[model samples]
Target chain A: MADATDSSDPVDALLATVDDGDVAFDGLRLEPVADGDDGRFALETPTLDRSTFGRSELRDVLETVEEYVTNWYYWQGDVGGEGTARRAFLRWCERAPVVGEAVTAPSAETTLEANRTARETANGTAPETTAEADQSLQVPQRQDALRDGIDREWGQLCITARFVDVDEPDGVRVYDLWHVDDADSDVADLEVYDDPRTAREIATTDEDGRYRPLKTAPTLPSGWAFTGLSGDELVETVGSVYPATIANWHRERLGELDVDHWLETAERQTGIYDVVDELPRDAVEWMADACCVDSQCLRRREWEYEEGDELDVDGGDGPFPCREPCSLVVAAARKWAILESETERTYELELTTSEFNQLGELIDAVAEGRTDEIREADLGDGANRYRARYLRAKRFDDDGLEARKRPEEY
Target chain B: MQALVVAAHGSHLNPDASDPTYAHADAIRETGAFDEVREAFWKEEPHFREVIRTLESEEVFVVPLFISEGYFTEQVIPRELRLEGWDPEQWDSDGTSATEVTLSVGDANKTVHYCGPVGTHDAMTDVIVGRAERVTEDPDVGEGFGLAVVGHGTERNENSAKAIEYHTDRIRERDRFDEVQALFMDEEPEVDDVTDFFESEDVVVVPLFVADGYHTQEDIPEDMGLTDDFRLGWDVPAAVDGHRIWYAGAVGTEDLMADVVLERAADAGAELGDAIEIVRAGAGGSVTEPADVDGTAGTTKTGD
Candidate 1:
């Protein structure tokens, strides 16, 4: 219930003015009383004074309790008046969004978004991680890979390549390079090319038509061509063009006919998969693909006969919501994610992606100093040393370091 | 193919109020990552219903241009986009059409896989910094010395500050800046506190509000002691004493906002494929349903 003494004087004044502005609302409902006391004038909405605007004008509605606050703390009762004003404010504070929510709503979320937009133009000290991440992210990775391929082939094709044209359907764009270069340099992975190698490749193709990795760095073209090259002499440049494979999509449900067949068959024949089984192999496969969760992982967790060693957690995906609202799960998952993320960095492999990686991939994927990529690869195979579930542990040295392993493995 | 729709809470009282947003949209459209750029508002020429009704593309990428993720972001935009109860495959208006519409919270398509709103881009900070530069560029003629950023700060959304703070911080970093501060139409670092808190040479007060409305024209000026716009000879001081002040039009007042709004109608020429055939929807930016402005909505140029 609202503070009994609020009197709706200040709030009422706000409503009156805001309404007079004729701010059209899809559904505007202002309930003077949240306690469901509509008939009584004791809790009449400030807008109730209008003859055209009826009681229902505030139904299915939004409660925009805009207090004519002198300061930001008025709704929070921080202004500190003794009697009715303070009491009413305390009640207002009850309805006022919590401090964290307000902060998250106003600051973190807003800053993150606007910072993203102004990222290109704004000259602000890249305040925090999110902005930094965008800086790295905006760099086209696939193009970088192609450039890297070219660089390895030709030797630092062009790291200083200004974007001549990034938006191209040809899978490649051209950049004007001052010089031509040799194509076979292994250091390609260390750089970025001005244009996709294909563009340079086409322009400087030798008579044999063999893609000379190090085509002499081509002559300059117009608009944001390779400006200046730093490090390593040779006016000649080597390059490679690698196919942009669809790698690690955030969500992908594809090429799983086997599971779909299983689901369809089960849905028709036994009819059990629909009710009892629910998730047919095909359906599970699709979900796995959609979620980017491995089919093997899904299969291992679902099968009844599997040892506890196969599963990471006791409950499987049940604990996770396939759907969201999930604020609880999202928040919890965020903690685990953050832990994994930070921990992954120390690993030799660079488990989680971060902006700093562009400084270069992590030396290792150390979940707990487990040396990232190498460690995970070394711990390879879907083999389970645990009791019932599969143990997905990376090697600290040879043996896994921490965390409760699968039951059988334990 | 992401169709970026810059949705806004429109104003019924005035059309010019939508100008700033259209301007911003125009700037974004030139970037060209979006398959289409459009704007949907609660009011003004093209109402929300007509905008959504006009979506010609299979998918729409909605970016709520609101500064906060409050009632509008959480409730209204999602509700309007019909995001509630949407199954991924069927999340679109026609389910199987591949015509999809995603509601990006703020501009983080980095996580969502879709190219989202410009808010997340560091490049956009350039706009704010640029806007501020406009004020600080000249004192007697342009905004010089004192720089005041007037934003609509809400306690509910910390995001509103991202724009204000980003611009303020960026300008403050410059050598030319005498002083750069942020003031809100609402909440803390408010208009009232401008004189007491901020210390700068010449004040250039830029309205963070998307449009010139009650707050920008009426409230902000009144708070800054320019209470009387009607006076002629006195010369409206951008600031009092050494603290000079200037006014930068709302960031949203760009001409592109109109294109963003017009883009919502997929059939509206700016769309891909087959031309949008409307009877009288010819060139001048006019519409019959919600009333026109001598020109048809679809035929109007992309932005102001």
Candidate 2:
């Protein structure tokens, strides 16, 4: 960990220590947001507002880190580019206590000890000491166990290289190892390495890197190669060997990416946002009456529509804190419209102007509850069908009027 | 005698909420027990109100296929069907009362027998126990596992919890499992606190809901930390927390429920003349109607 008392500029002070042979260090700081008046932590940044990110975003980042760290060797081999940066940051978070405590990295000895203890407990046998257990454990078994242990603990910390845009023969690329608990603080400082090979050599070298050293370096599996690869490329290349690791890495990335552009388009097309834009007063009032999808928006009554006012369809981008085109509203409207369109419906008869006028009269008669008077009118062909249509139209008109008249009824 | 309508609280968002009701209705219809066996839902078509208009039968028996005797069974069914003898004002002021009423509908004084919900029937305790027992790896060594009867309890009404407690007590009396407890989704002794209730490593949680809807399919499994990868109506045990959690489908969807519905219908004084034929054909010897056996009238098979 870099000494805090070095200088005022934490980034430059830390960066100054990086040499050609030493581990590479990136100046990026990941820290926890501080508490605010609203009893929530607000991210203090220039590019993003205090309200732009929340605990959810922090959780996503942590989840990403957790995945990469838990399966480090796989990520080291298979994933490349930005993935390497994320893995590196996570490793740094693990090694650097200022960032976060690393997840428990189980060792071969510990795993063997645990298995023996479990066996003893289940069999009701007397517990054996470490020395006794070690004496009975075979050499090949121990080696296999140790290999499994390190493999399990792979990516237990952020282990990746960072390339800084500097005028250097090796391109100023540095390997980093650090860990930061997402909940504790947002600020994370990395431990840097000069090159990928140097970083791996140090990592495997007992008492030097984040991991505990094995008695002997485990033999590499068939087809394993680390030559000619950058620190990031090495991690990705290693990660690619394990199918699950790469698959999970891809799965996590897919979740992070917003692929629901159709959902947004659907919301924009049919949402109350467009309705509000068209008839600001009536639509907003209708929404208020219809009840805004957000249960927390208590200012629904006070929401008055101005001509130039725009409802925040995204719930955060607008000037006003109106949750007008909420997810529920969009979903409900889309579903209702879809159901209406999908249902088998037809208008069989194309009436003449005279027939249309008569139909209107019939609808009015039904709306006015003049059924007794309409019963005495002259009967025409398809009279029953016309009457049914008239009743349906009247009911539709009544429903529309009712919706407008008393929005509270909904 | 004319028509049998299974009334349920359906969901507009989840169509599967009303699926079991429709399925049960179809099964019962195949028996030809009544003129028509139809499903009436509050959310879907044919709607509860619109259902009556379509029913050509003068006499109707509406058996609420809900798990407990709560708001939906007592209030919603009565209100929607416009059944006589239930005061709308009294229902609105006090909600559903404990007293079950048999109402008459239409000017012809057509009898509309409002039977007790299928869940509240005395035979249902056995159904719940059976659900839990099916998932038990060793049925003979019942002491190794715990049985949890989960219900959709409501804070608004104590009756919801009471029904669950009633079934739990009966299951406990049988003394088949090491422990039998009642848990709720919306009340104390919640589904989340299930581990605290059971010391046994293996626990079987049987949801006493009416359908394999959102609550059963998503919420309960999520709360219990069980993977809900299976489709709706899949009755299988999921492993969680080093224990096997046998999540049974809602009690209302069980094949044996056809018997319970007929029992409810019989209790309401409906002449179930061809019920034996329906049970024999539809349930395949699963349902034993009271009227089928001599001196077995009003006597249901109970858990020991």
Candidate 3:
């Protein structure tokens, strides 16, 4: 429960302002007794029973508010907490039109009056601020702002926390965490989970049932949510879906992220991976460009060649920072080192200019993971499925490409 | 006193690589020996760099569930844990030495007693023997079958082969098997030559590696002619090259590995007082036997 002992805060201010008449805003209604029987008042919501409390029992009212709003995605810790990924996400939820227009938008009259007042004030003239703007904008009820719910998109997940009419207060607040694809689907239409571990299982595969080696790859499947999770449970589910994302994001905000650069990480390799250190510095850049791109991974790489020697390529633009090169990178570097050790050899092959361009287009399409988007019917597209098949049929023989043998075979 | 951490090299592709580690931790947790038992991974959640900070315990015992003492145990875990006295230059220094290391975490000091890996423990010899006997489904199967211990050997680190060789020698000295020969995956006398190396008509190959991942599940089985197609599991006692062979899964995945981890941690805990005493004596401080040293034996221990 939120402590409401302080009289100067917004909760007490709202409580003090409610006179003998009732004040109604959002889904809550507060009324004061005309008889003033022990200074008691009734606080009522559609989902919960009307409860009468004395003026001194403000903490009980605050507790009810806390329980009600927190269930509706009003994460108290992140609301006024450090500017972490969670805080950034909340800001996006309130400002960006995730599902539709922003819910906190003021009335049309209020907006028009504010725009006119802003134009006059900026012109350095006597302020023509409407009398209604001062009362509605400046002196708006703080309680109405506190009761606001959230609806936002995080990765592929559509999160909705809002008040819903139900028989009990526990059921008043409903939180729905589902796939963004299923935003229009009813709750009964989607598969629901309650345990955090279920998120880990869901993350193991993609839509085509292929194993997702990279958890943060932009291929998370749809149609499921760990619905009705508490704030702690929701965080745990997110952690299981994308491990260490919150921790790394928080560490970066605190400026305490320990980044192990490519050279430092490669030098620490032992066993068969010790050969990774022997990779030429130029080859390191190529590996990062190939593997650390946003198309392949979803982490913002913080590591570089070393301190003050950033890579020429762009790191990913993910919301969370990758403090070090993951094990997948290290393992891949080992194989790359072996491949890089081979001597350069040249073999002659005949191909037309268009054929060479088509080959490049094919490679680019595969590398950027856009092959699936190139439909087989799109024959005009060089990297289309059927077009690639035709290229393979023309260039490939049983022996090798273009009937050309390798230098070693010759 | 508060927690036991079993650290292992997990794989990003194979979720089952950490299954055995989690199962062992759960088994130990059910025993109620410690307040918490956690499994940290090199390639999974609760990563080595962050698992320590998540611990509420002041005293922690970290036991590596690796097959042998090598790169990961010696360099990676210590550096990731940020041990107070870890020196990067000392490549030959054994990080598995039963010693108390202080982790300086923001002014307060936390004690982490690093224990030797469970794979190199003497009790692991029993795990190998158990794997052999279970695969054969006979208590006295060692009398007729030659046991082959396979390891992921590398020229980069001679210690990887040494651990397998030590276990092979230990098993041979007991005279429980008809024949025991150490085989390597990357060195000579490879696991592929298992059927031809021994005179016995029947052989039982037990992989002395951690996790039943790629190596134990596919590579070794495929190379030994136990399975023609690439798959995860192999039904053993299949005839190959005129020899009937029983291929067991990786020894680290065996249920007895939980006991091995507990043994490693308990041994380090039992030696903690002696380690302190030796440091005290080296500093010319008078050492006296503590009066409250309990003789109760098992996994749980009290730290003063």
Each prediction's TM-score against the native? Answer: 0.32, 0.39, 0.66
lDDT of 3 by residue, B2-110 (tens): 6788998776666666767876776675666765566787777667766665444667888888877777777788866776676433324342233233345331246
Q: Could you tell me the lDDT of residue A51 within candidate 1?
A: 28
lDDT (Cα, tens digit) per residue for candidate 1, span B1-304? 4455667765533444455555555455554545545566644323332233222244565555554323454444554344534343332222111222333322122111122223323333444444545434432332335667777877766666665676567667764556677888778888766767656555656665545555554556556664444121112345454465555545444332333233333322234332212211222221111111112222211111
DockQ-derived CAPRI band for the predicted complex in model 2: incorrect
Error of 2 at B238 (Å): 3.8
Residues A207-242, model 1: lDDT tens digits: 444322211212222122232331111111221211
| Predicted structure 3, TM vs. truth | 0.66
Candidate 2, residues A1-410, lDDT tens digits: the string is 11321433322332232211121111111333444533222222112333423444644542422221212212222232222223432232122110111111145643343334223322343332222111222222322332322111232222333323222211223333332121122222223333333433332223322221111112112111222344444443333221113222322222221122222323334213233233323334444344442332221211234325434432221111221233333334444444444434333344557656766766655544355544434455223445556645654454332123233333
- CA lDDT, candidate 2, residue B127: 68
C-alpha RMSD of each candidate structure in angstroms: 31.7, 31.5, 13.1
Off by over 4 Å in 2: A1-410, B87-100, B106-109, B136-143, B228-236, B274-304
Chain A vs. true chain A, TM-score per candidate?
Answer: 0.16, 0.18, 0.63
Give lDDT: candidate 1, residue B233.
Answer: 14
User: What fraction of the real A-B contacts shows up in model 3?
Assistant: 0.34
Q: Which candidate is the best by TM-score?
A: 3
Compared with the true structure, all predictions reach lDDT values of 0.34, 0.46, 0.64
